[model samples]
Target: MFDPQTQDQPLPQRLTRTLIIGAVVILVAIGGFTLIRDQFTEEEPPPPEPSAAPSPQATAQPTAPAGGDNLAQVDDWFPHSRTEFAEAGGVAADFAADVATIDYTRDDWDSHAERLGQWATDPYAVTLTTADGVAEGIWRALANDADAWTGSADVVEVTYFDPTSVTIVVQVQAEPDTGEDPTDLGEFSVDLTTNEGPGWRVDRAELLR
Candidate 1:
């Protein structure tokens, strides 16, 4: 029994079906949009902080020793001169003057001998047994000659020096006993030792040709 009137639904039923279909399509569109938006979006990371520079106070610095630069000041361990005779120049000058001031005619040979004795020591002292010995030798040599003889010694240089001792090189010039011209005795090297009591004294002498 198919009837043309029944085939055409009622208006209220058609309206309800239409409203339900439209609601389903809207829900589907909203779900798909939410999924797509979530897939494309991302959480951003935090920015990096700047590094700090080194400060002058953080650097290592060199410092001097506790004694306040020990190398800059001289220590007591080093030897020092306490007397004038310990000085090389003064001792050398005195020795040269004594050697050149000998006069055979001067009756005061004792004074010359005493001065020489004061300057000489050990081996040189043995060379001149007594102050008179030096005078006698020179007197014997100048007895026959009447010419005025003069002797002079020039300190050429100080070869070596220390707190205890010094060596000097000297050039000696003397007028001949024959009244001839002065002659050079070449150079002489003398070693002297320092004494606490007597100061500096000659221990050895050598004629360096």
Candidate 2:
């Protein structure tokens, strides 16, 4: 459908007008196709942000045991194995309990001292058996009173430690047969020598009260 006036134009002019209209039509069609594609085609999801790296967890520190000879509680035992530490702690605890407990009615102080001697050095053993020694004094005093007492000990902690020595603090509880409240003998600091004399023997012991 050509216009009569357009038909009458010169051949070059008519050709130019026809070409321009075709170009406009093509441009319009291309724009419409782009709009339709944008409407139907889902936009790709934005790239997921990389997750933050997990934070490093903190390392846990070693903790001391509440009581008993837990070998794991021994941190430093240079020149000695953990077995030695456990043995030393056990010997101190036993000595503390026995020394603080007495039964005057049974007349067993000699036997008790004999047992304790196994854990002491020769000189200390003599001290325990001597008439004027601390053990004898304790035995006589309790026997005179005719009172029986029992004791128990808990290894509170190791206060000092070295290559050949360690100091342990024990909590002693002495209860009398009269049924009164148990007496707290306070903390006993028992110093022991590992390399000298017997393997882990008490060198000296004193109350820290």
- Per-residue accuracy of model 1 over 1-209 as CA lDDT, tens digit each: 88888887767988989999999999999999999998888566677877787665865678877777665554444454434423655565566545555565663555665666677775666565453343344435544554445666777887876777778887766675676876655677777786633567777666677
The residue ranges of model 1 lying beyond 4 angstroms of the native Cα positions read: 1-87, 107-114, 130-148, 176-180, 196-198
Q: All candidates' lDDT scores? A: 0.63, 0.77
lDDT by residue for model 2 over 98-136, one digit each (tens)? 886887666587886776676676677777776744456
- Among the numbered candidates, top lDDT falls to 2
Task: Rate residue 146 of model 2 by lDDT.
Answer: 34
TM-score, every prediction: 0.45, 0.53
